[model samples]
Target: MNNEAIDIILAEDEPALGMIVKESLETRGFKVRLCNDGAKAYKAFEESQPHALVLDVMMPELDGFSLAKKIRLENEQIPIIFLTAKSQTEDVLEGFDVGGNDYLKKPFSMEELIVRIKNLLNRQEVQKTAAIYAIGDYSFNFPKQRLTYKDDEEVKLTHRESHLLYHLLQKKNKVLDRSFVLKKLWGNDDFFSGRSMDVFVTRLRKKLAKDDRIEIINVRGYGYKLMVP
Candidate 1:
């Protein structure tokens, strides 16, 4: 999205189709590494660590599903789209079961393939910056401003408390600069704003006291660090 080329690994046995797909993806600014067999693709994946994979179900050295399972063992988050001529229900189910994120039947349009790749990447990015986070034994839902401990009733947090907690969690175990947080939440790092942040931090400490492993420590001359084991 920011002119950074997306890298893709494509494993296809058909020479002609493989070349066409490679050229099409490159034309749209994707850096593609085309492998003629599943074995070669696996090797390429090890070396390149591409963002996503497009694999043909039937290959020379290994099959796509097997390759996907192997890759899953190494990395679970990479998006995989299986390309195959077979459209059986079991085949589709097997694809999902074997860690394939999406399945595309053969004779598919390049445009459709591109869309799926983009969509999967987008979904993955969203997951990386999810609103829900786990803090020791507590679950913090940023959107709802609720913190729940085990099976206990959820504690409703104020707007400032929720925002402050989110930033602290974002930099968990590291000192979050006081000035940066002040400007982020209150638009200024004045004396009153800093005092307000301290109050909110105190309130948060009380709420999170249920979890003994969690701590919000003030770093003398620096800021606060949310410590979670």
Candidate 2:
């Protein structure tokens, strides 16, 4: 077993180039799934659920932009890198709008590609460990989404509840931008989501009510504030 270091889906139609990239990454401890065409790449992606993507913009059956958009519809966090020959400003912007994390122009250095991938993975790890927070008498384990109270009670939180609490806690003593919270969690700040956010906030207030020192206040017309005294 080669330790499958970082799972990468490589979608390059050129057989020789694909082999070179795949061998290069594997030698460096990355587990790569090489698909010669876009359709096969998309299928492999769904089946293997790789950690990241290295997709060529021009491919048979489906282009990189379409594939990335499809994946983003299901997952917003997976890092996607577009390997393209087109370096037009509009092309780059379109890639970003379709949820690309980075773009590597054709004729790029393999070393640079490796570095970018590592940097993106590192950044994700950093974002994953936002910060453990202390609210009132509770210790929030953000990574595990667990809340421990009084050293004896560990409360597991639902995904929504946990993420909502994280955002609120991160802005302790200040207003949590309502729009930002909605966009980050729900992917939008539509009327329905805004209302739903209000409901979730109310639920959190009740959940943390055990500690009188902890309060989540609505800062009318702005956002909510988590106050820990």
lDDT of residue 153 for candidate 1: 67
- Segments of candidate 1 deviating more than 4 angstroms: 2-4, 132-229
lDDT of 2 by residue, 1-229 (tens): 2335689999999999999999999988889999998899889978987888999999989999999889877776677888999976567657765777677788988898887787666646755867777888998876665788877688765445777898888789899999998776654687756776787788788778789989999988898999997
Best by TM-score: 1
State the TM-score for model 1.
0.58
**lDDT score, residue 228, model 1?**
99
lDDT value, residue 108 of candidate 2 = 82
Clash pairs of candidate 1?
none
Best by lDDT: 1
List runs of model 2 lying over 4 Å from the truth: 1-4, 131-229
Score residue 5 of candidate 1 by CA lDDT. Answer: 63
Q: Report the C-alpha lDDT of model 1 over 125-195, residue by residue, as the tens digit.
A: 75467678899999997656689998576997654577689889999999999999877655468775576
The per-model lDDT (C-alpha) reads 0.84, 0.80
